[model samples]
Target chain A: MKLIIFPPIPSILVSLFVFLALRHFLELRERAPRLNWLLKYLWVLALPLLLVVRITGSRWDTGVFWQIDAVYVVLMVALAGVVLIRLRALQPARTLLVALAPFALYALAKVPDVFLDNLMVFSFGNPADIYWLFSIAWLVGGTLVAYKQQTLLQQQRLEHELEARIKARNQELEQLVEERTASLVRQAGELRETLEELRVTQNQLVQSEKMASLGELTAGIAHEIQNPLNFVTNFADVSTELLGELREEQQRGQEADPELEAELLTDLEQNLTKITHHGHRAASIVRGMLEHSRASTGERLPTDLNQLADEYLRLAYHGLRAKNKSFNATLDTDLAPDLPLVEAVGPDVGRVLLNLFTNAFYAVQQRREQQPGPDYTPTVRVRTRLLPGGSVQISVRDNGTGIPEAVRQKIFQPFFTTKPTGQGTGLGLSLSYDIITKGHNGTLSFVTEEGQGTEFIIELPLSARNSPAPTPGGPAVNPAPQTERSSG
Target chain B: MNILVVDDELDVRALFEQRFRREIRGGQLRFAFAHSGEEALDYLHEHASEVVLILSDINMPGMSGLELLGHIRQEYAAPPPPAPPQVMMLTAYGDDDSRRQALELGASDFLTKPVDFVALKQKLLQLAAHDDAPPL
Candidate 1:
């Protein structure tokens, strides 16, 4: 190695830089990768170029150049063939043939060089030395390429294993999703079953409520009739006694003064008058109660809208006031004077108006609570007007908390109310709806704005059929709950 | 003997006044009226010694007839030298519950409305007669 002189250090550095730079360039464009033939063949050029630089510009002998040249040729041919074979671009035979081309050309040129060397004088080392150097270079470059290819195959296997794991995980995830979907479907079925059970229970509860209302009505009747009965029996007994006294006085007329006779007779007459008056009063009360209890006569009677409205408005207001001392609001009534009879069920129309007025009052009261001040001044206005189509329009408007948009659709639904627990039955509007539409052949509707106010409108045609209001044991028989709660 | 008629009904006052008119004018009986249990209790508080009997209706608006009975039994327990004032209860309901409660609260008699005025008059007359009898 010393005889071969110092191995050109700058050449080694420059050649390595060029080879690594080209390999990195190919790697960067790995997506569209081509064979890195330039990377392999670069060493072949570098060895020769170094030799030429030593030969032409330095004091190296011609024999040394020839030996180096032969070693470079054989090493280049062998490494090039290995690179071609590793690339998988050619069969072994073709790669061997292509790799031998440069050596073949060198051999042909050597023939002429040997003849020239015979004529002109130059010294070279033994042929074995060139073969020895060529063997060393070929061994090193071929092993490096083999090692690099082995590493690439190992990395490829690792990537294949990773891909298989990912595929398996994805399949498991899909199975889990399918199972979750099945479980969700099963739960939905169970929920539907529970819903059906709830509906049945709700129906039973409604039946119980009807029975309870009947009980309350009976108790109320018993209490109400007691007062009139007291008067009736007392007055009747008093009259009988008075008549007996008058009879005795008449028997004593022989001894009695005319004045005493007249006074006794007058007292008996007055007792009779009181008995008649109280008897009639008791009879009328019974009549009113009977009318209230019986289902409608199913006949259309001329209904008075204003009188009904006025009576119930005062009743509902006073009723609420009686129950709740804190409740107060301004009530305004606008009745069209001389309004014609609607020819509808009187109680049914009365019920619709009362429900509207109650809801209006409730709204204003709730609003007043949320924003309390002297200036708040909650007001409810009830208006009745006859439309051109022979329909009566009764509207109850209140300046109170309005119907919420989210709950508006459900307002008329049975058992739907925004009132706090126990304050409402949530059936008022629903029953009113049934009475106006199904019971009286009328329409019930409302308009509302959040936090501002609400207005309920009831429209009844003048010549509606005489359908009994639902209250005298219609669907309310099973209405199960809200009727006992309703004051109207 | 003084009698207290307690009821919220105005008609009750007129009816009682007329029914006992002969006795009242003859000085055989005196009648005092109170509109509610509270009024009855107030009148009795002032004139408890003079009143010989109290006939109270059960369901007055203020203090109930049963409540008045409790108050009278507790606060105005008449001494036994003379008979404790007899208390009769009247109720529109005439329920077993009201009857039991009134009796338990020391009501001497329980009557349901419309009460038999004849029976009531006879009972008062007997009480007057008992008062007239010689002391043991």
Candidate 2:
């Protein structure tokens, strides 16, 4: 048989193409999952078949070809079948094992041919074909291994970068949440302050309404009392003249001197005295009621605070007694001797004192009610003292059942009253507070214990009487009195 | 002399009438009563030239006595017509504001309620004396 020759250059080219095809199949499988099975099958079987066809071209009739060619065909066919099975199962290890088996067999089959040829040629076999086959197999196997190593390295690098980006995003989200939470907390604090301010404003408004109603009621009562007082004064005047006439008749002895003249004179004197006394008392009562009912009237003036307190205290006590005849409480005043004259509206200041006196009276009465005995006489002490820095401190103290702690804090609040509904407008203390504090540029505060008693303290700056006119939206300052002292 | 007493309370008007009974019957003064500011104004309108004096309460529902006085002042701004009544304000509230307002509104004088008859008589006698005097 003619010597068969296989072109070495074409075989090398086929092996090179097989390597490229395997690379393309791997890229397709990674990038596109839908085409992965098809690409893997082509990589495992088709490329190898093409390699064989190229290596065996025009060399089929050689005697040695029949022997090695059949073995090559069987091994190639077995590789194809294993690769096809692996593709169906999609197993990476199985595919690699099947691919490596045929490559190993092909390399080993060329060993015998190399040994025999070397022995015949130069007392040593020519091993060129075996060497070529073994080198080709090694190239294919090494290329596959290198490709796998490169893919694993690339996957590890991508995972590390992705993990870093995720951590950064989570940190940014946490910071945003913190900032939003802080803003919400700030807004809540502002809302709470606003609510407290609104509550104070509402209290002021209710107190003003109560003052208006009380003014109306006092005015009405004063009108009703005026006529009786006038009658008392008139009758007393008439009786005095009649008594004078009777004494003149007795001196002349014009009538029967049955001692009727003396008796008539004495009776007239007593009746006239009683009538005059009661008439003046009623007149004072009306005046006090009138002052209490009146609203702020004129500009502020420099006032003798001690005298003002005394007059209002008298009126307040009488007014309380008039309402409840059994309500008898002694009031003691401890006015400062050298208290500097403070400028304030006399009528308005009088009203504030009246409120305090009335409240003290009520507190003492309440205490008396709780303790049942003849000796349970209630007493209210009103004292004024000159403080350093031209300030005056006035306090009203009562030995009454003190306010409970739970309600003590709320006493100055408008509409918060311990008295029964009809008896109190509930604005008295709040109005008094406003008058002393905001209206007079002073301070009003109180202290109380459960069983001991209660005391309301007011401090006024002497300069407050001459305070400048209040601007709109600013707190109201009391108007100063306009007149100088005339007579007591 | 005809006197008009204006107040909202019926009892207050009755008390005034009772107190002035002697003067009213003797024809030294004739009594007329109006229960509200509006009623007083209407009476004044009809008897403008006849009323000798007016005693009015300052606080009344609807139109106050002060408002009535204001109307009277406006109507009699010039030399008052014949027998134009002298107006006096009577109020339970003796505040300076009311007093100033009353005086400003041309009220001749003011007296607080629970009135003293002696003081009232003295004021009436003084007003009568002033009325007897010729206008300067």
Candidate 3:
């Protein structure tokens, strides 16, 4: 017996196991380049050769039995050559080892057989059985190792993709934050500029108020002065015409009646007297205007409160009338008969009184315009009283639109105004308050009912009555009578 | 011709009377005076048909010239007196606003003070001639 130790069935079974292991390794070819090429050649050359040699040797009996051993040695040499040449390019050393394990173990199992057969000494009980057993164990172990390596590679690929996405998201968030911060900084700069512009406008408004006051004074002065000046020129012109007529009569010689000449002379004399009177009246008005225009001397003098009130009241009324010729209001004054003089700056006090009177007139005028019914009459009342506490109280009241509740607190604040832009400087009441409370040691206050009326009161102590050298400021009675009107 | 003069100044009456002395004496023109707008309206109400012309001051104590003009235009618009008297406005303010308002309110003419007697006389004479002409 030639010992038939390499049974055909076992041979086919080991080859099949090797085929399945190598197929699994082929799927990981990209991960293990050198080992993948080695396994591919083993599948194509060694597996088929082993099958052909076993079939031929089994049929021919002893004729080609050495051919199987020859083909095995050749396949092993070819696999070793390929693995050695491409070894450096292979990645992940553990998976490469697992992929090449079956081939390497098979080659080792064949080493003793090749040496023993080449020496031609002893054919010891068929070493082919040990080789076949080694083949089955290595193939099964290699397949399991290859499957484990494939799972690890897939997990690593997933982790790398997730890390890249996280980095890109972080970069996007940082860029958004930067853009928002820049926009906020730009808006802050714009707000700063707007505040600066508002401050400049406020300053300009204050300056405009002074100009407005001067303009009002000039208009009032011009209108008041024009009336007397008109009389002066007209009288002078008439007198001249009268003289020409008288000369023409004399030229008529005997035809001229004596009665006509006397009448002409008498008229001429009367006209001259009238001219002088008007001229004097114009001069007095000019004097008062000059005093008004002069800068206040700030010199305190014993001033009659009643006289001061009356003068400012007229001045304020005329000033308003000069701007709007259609404006009219009744003036009611109740001046105290026994009021004593007080030491105060005349122009300063006059300025305070003018501000109060102008405000009262403006309020009434506004109301009258809104309510044009026949029953609505615009009235401003001024009263002076000697209080028992040795102080003089002056109140100016108006039947007009009163101060609204919202603005009452800020009424005397600087740069606060109820009037429209360009009409008021917002300094009138503030300056008046300063002149009364701070300058004269007096109190100025007001009471108001919205949509109805307002009353401003000013109280001054009478301790200055004993001050010597009282300068008597000229005070005149109200020129226009107040009575029930058919239309007001 | 009958004319009414209105002004707040009391001396305006004397000045106008003396200035038109020749015409007044010859009975060519008769003049009446009122010291304020109220007085002028009262006079106008009493002698409704007598006044051929009216001269009024704009700035006055009781009623303004514009207000008086409005009242006159509304109250005396009837044709009984052939035509409503022509109104001439006199103002110390020669501002265009007042002049425009006066014209809009039916004032026939506007004058700024001090009154120019020479120009005034010419205007009065022309008006008198226009009035004296026979109706077409």
Candidate 4:
């Protein structure tokens, strides 16, 4: 059998390579759970095995005995058997122990050689060779352990940094969501406030419309009542004359005949009766005017606008005629069929119709005054129809001396009127505009020409739901020439 | 004396004619009628110096009593204007502003409708007395 000799250069290179590989292995073992088991067992058993192998290999002078070779082969076999068992079991700790066994035996065998060489003082072999091998093994093992500790510390630092970054990211996401939710809530609140304001504006418009209609009625009533009052004054004057004449006859120095006295009494009674009748008639006219002029107050209910117009027209016409029996004008009505019921304050709406009718009557009367000839008898027309977009429109047209263009625009302004100073309050159209536009979410307008006549149109929403609730600072019905009057 | 009753109501004029039957018979008073402010103005223009007093409603279509009063005042304020008749205003609304405006327009007095017959007669009597007196 030939023995292999180790060159000094190869031995040093092998030792350095082995030292580096072992250091790297120990570093990997500490960081990974897979290496934890290996670390425990390799440190315990593999160190001793490597030392034994080293000791035996270097002690060749003790004997070239076959037993030593046998022992070396047996130790190698045992080491290889441990590796096979660890591989088969797939245990990290066992594999590390087996892997270290050969190195440990080599190291141990080197130790024994050193001890033997030193014990024989006269021996020719150098003990320094054995010392060098043992020193190299210790250096390699110490470096591997030191590298393992450093790797473990670095891994812990990485884990802590990763955990902190994750926590910070989650906190930022939560803050962003909260900010977005708060903005949405604020926007929703603002929207609700705007809706509430719109409701308030709508209510104010309706109230103003009612007031305008009442004012118009007041003017009409004043015009209508003046006629009958004139008659009362004249009749009273005439009756006083008759009474004076009767008293003069009684004072005369003559035997007053019972029959003659009775006839005189009868005549006086008849004339007085006529005076009383006429006076009462005038009073009734004034009463009707007052009632019509009062503000409308009623509960909201579903009502047909067409029926309301018809009824009020008749009442207004009769009331006007009662005061001025000589005022002769024809009334015409054009009402649409099958209008849906409108939710409204019934009395309030009725008053509006009454005001419109009376104005129409006065307009015709004015026409008659302007042209006394029989060729032109005054005529008033009232019309109602369902307008587009679910609204009802009512118009009162008069064939009278039409409104002048210059003053037409100013007519709806409060305290603006063509009538004499003592005659008009000028609030009629202004109040009417407010009611229809603001109160009912409706519209009122008129068309006029200097000679043709005037037509007033009122548009009202058909249903309560279609009418928007009043809102504060929302668009309100404005009483001006644009809305109140038109020129054709 | 011939008198004209201006009013829009036929019944009112008829009542006046009925009450003054004795005056008509004795030739103490004669009556004519006009139904509107314009008519009354036209009648006054035609009858120049014949009317004793003008009683009018302040509220009337086309022209009101106050406007008529202004016209009357203007006519009388001029030179050689025919005997200025006494003017009175009657109205349903007796608001202070309206009454003040009427009186300022040279109306003799303002009365509300329905006027008291006795009071109106007394006013007419006083006006007639003044008419008989010489102008200041």
Candidate 5:
């Protein structure tokens, strides 16, 4: 068998470099598994063929030796081309070019030997030196490729770690926001509960104050009605006796005197008149009391302000008198003669007037006790006037110690009072103010001179009868123009 | 027997006068009227010795019947004019507080209006009998 001459070391070294670079490049790539596997195993076949060509030196046929050499070179070059194309996207251009260096050197070394016939043109340089240089070049190229692959692997690992840390931090931040939102919702629920509790407590206080005022009026009402009732029964009894006497005289037949009969008849007639008058008085008082106490219908009615003020003034005066018999106050009422009927809730307005009158009486009574003499005459005056604007104003004044400068600002506030704790409910002025302002769309204000007297004025619109009734705790139909005016 | 009727109502005077008209005409009983406690006091000062009984209403403008009873009790504590004036309290309210207070103040009796004149006459007759006066 004939062998062909071939430089075996360069061929082997080039094969080794391509093999190492191809293996790493395939490892880096993760797609086209069947193709990558076939390309990588082809090196096993090419390495053996290369060693066989080098051992059989020119003893083989020339065509067969060259064909073996050409086949292995073609296989290795095909492997490098495939690897370069696959790793093009994954690796830098410089690293890919270095990977191809040994293949190019192999091709250069063989080309000269193949074209020139028996031309040992470079016989001056030993073939061993050329093999060593090519081997060293291949070793350096393989090392560089290996180093680049290691760097790319470490970079990929670091990127994966950074992505994992970011995901974990995002989850933690979501949990923190969720916890804060839940806490805020819980606090809002607690605040709503507290507000409801306070509203209930305020409602209870308002109810209790109403009951207290009713209690204060009961004694006076009883006394006022009882006086007329006494007269009613007594006159009836006396009339019965007179009738009996007159009948006895008439039954005496011819002895009965006409003058005595006529006198008895006259007495009977007088007694009946007295009885009727007292009965009417008692009934009127009861009717007034019932009207004041009935539940509010929340409807506007045409009401005579003069009569309402007069009735409440008398009621309040009698109530104070019933409590202490020695307590005296002169009541002066100046009612407008042609005052237009006011559009108001009758019972609600009555209550406000009663409260104001009661407070006035109390103030005067207090001042009377403090500075008593014939000189200081306690008096409460009520004056009703028709303003030019379609409204009416009622003023309640007292000759008594007025409100202090410091406490006047809080006079209409609920649960604020100058009276001894048990004596006053403190809700009187506040409720009265609300009734006049919110219930009737009227203004309730006061003017006071410290130590002299205080006058509370209530101005109610007369033409608001057709307007919608004010709903409880809702905005008034027309806000009072003077609502913001502070009273002193 | 001279009796003083004290009340705040003006109509009480006419009612009492008519009720005891026969007795007044027959001279068996005499009725004097005063409008209030202060007027009653003035009347008592003038006719303290002649007054045999005082009927005063408990609820009045100036002074109450209980207070008047207290005043009378102090004034006629150890008196000797036929007899110390007996005070009867009259009130519209038939409450325990007023009754108890009237009694505590040495009131001779407590009456609620409209007073039963029949019962009142019987009581007055009983007192008149004790005083050796003729009953109407």
Candidate 6:
């Protein structure tokens, strides 16, 4: 039987086209086993085989066919070896291609004698059909295996993509959680700061309240003792005078009984000295108490209003803080630098400022509790400025619960208080009023708004009937005569 | 010279009598006790001619020494005697308010008590000497 070979030009052109196709699909992307090995690779083998046989002319007698077959076998074996070494990835389809390439080359060299005779004569007959069945079964089985492997690779790729997406999602969730936690931490920090402020305020308030109650107790004790003290001092002097008379009688020799008079005089002298000593002691003690009970208005001197206001503002803020543990407020002060020192009782002015500041803080703190929010900031501000008139205006202002209209008129009356029992003496504003207006000849007034806050304004004259410069180690003496007013 | 001692305390009268016993015996100084300002005024009216000095406490039960000082200034100090009975006010408080008020009310002098009896005696002697000399 004769073998049919395709012409060289057309076969070569077809082979070149198939080679470019293989380069485009098989060379670019390593597809699944079905396409890479079972289908596309067959084109690689079949086309190469066709070229080898066509170049060799399918005539082994020329000896050129044998030479070309040998060369082709060498090239195929070398290509297979290089591919096998480079493809260490261990894919079943690629591994099979490398393994079969040399065998395919050798079979193409002998296809005319060995494969063509059976295909031409014994092809399509009943006997050949049996052979085709075996080949079909093998092809079907290989196709099945290739398809299964391809399906598995696709499944693996989908699983890999799902895993990546899940990892990305997890990282995003973790970042969100971290941000939330940080915000919570920051909020907690603010709360801690607020709590710390409250604690400081409470400590200061309690301390001031204790001092105030103690002062009240001291004043009460001093008042109670003053009357008895007067008697002791008076009687002691009277008794001493009696002793003097006895001495005078002895000097004049007027006693009817000398020995009896001498005994009585000696006893009276001893008792009088003791009484005088104790009487002076009591008197001095009472004097000290009187000094502490209130400002000795007679001792008014030039005082720095700004410095005084600032000091008492801090003191009052701290004082309020001590009383109320959960109360806190921002304190701000602006005292004029150019304020000339005004004539005032320093302690009295201090007390006035303290009263005003305490009231301001209380108002703000009440407002804060009533309207609870981050926006609500409790605050007390103290400002001092030299007014156009011959006076310094000191104002203690607060953004707080201001005086209600109904009770405004009663604020300055003695025994009137808005604070709960034991919290206030009810005499603070009245006494403060007296101190400012009467003690220092200052105007004590207020500017307030209901449900907002209050600002107490105190205006003191710069020149308050100039007092005498203090004499060294002596009590304050009015160098000049002054008119008297009702010292409230 | 008759001196009126006006105070609320009962012990003050005995104390004054004991102290001025020598003076009283010598007839140089005479002390009369009056417990209240009103009583002192009553005594003053009765012995206005004899009394040479009035030492009165400012604070008292019925009438304050200040009120009594006003009475004495109006009734006694006006028709000045040859030796006008010097009115000295005694007080427990040393503050200028009371002192000023006492002096304003025609008190001859102001003294804070637990009185210095030595000073009081000296003041008394000075007042007597001044009265003898002439009215200022």
Best candidate according to lDDT: 5
Interface RMSD of 5: 3.6
Look at candidate 3 and tell me the lDDT of residue B115: 84
Sorted on TM-score, highest at the top, how do the candidates line up?
Answer: 5, 3, 4, 2, 1, 6
* Native-to-model Cα distance after best TM-score fit, residue A431 in candidate 6, in Å: 21
lDDT of 1 at A488: 16
Best by DockQ: 3
Q: If candidate 4 were superposed on the true structure by all CA atoms, what would the RMSD be?
A: 13.2
In TM-score terms, which candidate is top?
Answer: 5
lDDT over C-alpha atoms for residue A12 of model 4: 30
Q: Which stretches of candidate 5 lie over 4 Å from their true place?
A: A1-199, A252-270, A284-295, A299-307, A337-343, A386-388, A463-488, B1-136
* Fnat by candidate, in order: 0.26, 0.07, 0.52, 0.26, 0.44, 0.19
The models' CA-based lDDT, in order, is 0.65, 0.63, 0.72, 0.61, 0.75, 0.62
The window of 10 residues in a row where model 2 chain A has the poorest summed lDDT is: A479-488
lDDT of 6 by residue, A213-263 (tens): 335335334433454465466556555665665576678765455764775
Write the residue-wise lDDT of candidate 5 on A227-281 in tens digits: 8888898899899989999999999999999998998898889889999999998
TM-score, cand. 5? 0.56
RMSD of each: 15.5, 20.0, 16.2, 13.2, 10.2, 20.1
lDDT of 2 at B90: 85
Query: Which lDDT tens digits does candidate 4 get at residues A1-488?
Result: 22222332223333334434543543445434444354334334434444564676754333332224434434443543443343443333244454455555554554455444323332225444455455445545644554554466457768888888888888888898899889989988998898788668545544454454444444445544554555556555655665666676687748655565565577667666766766776576565444444555545578778767765675666556544544656567898887778877666666666766766776777777788865785777889888777888898888887777678768667657676775545555665666666667677788877666788898888776777665567533354646444456
Alpha-carbon TM-score of each model against the true structure:
0.42, 0.43, 0.55, 0.44, 0.56, 0.33
For candidate 1, what's the TM-score of chain A, rounded to 2 decimals? 0.40
Cα lDDT over the full model 5: 0.75
The better-scoring model by TM-score among 3 and 4 is 3
Candidate 3's residue-wise lDDT over B15-68, tens digit each?
888888877888778999988778889999899888989999887755777777
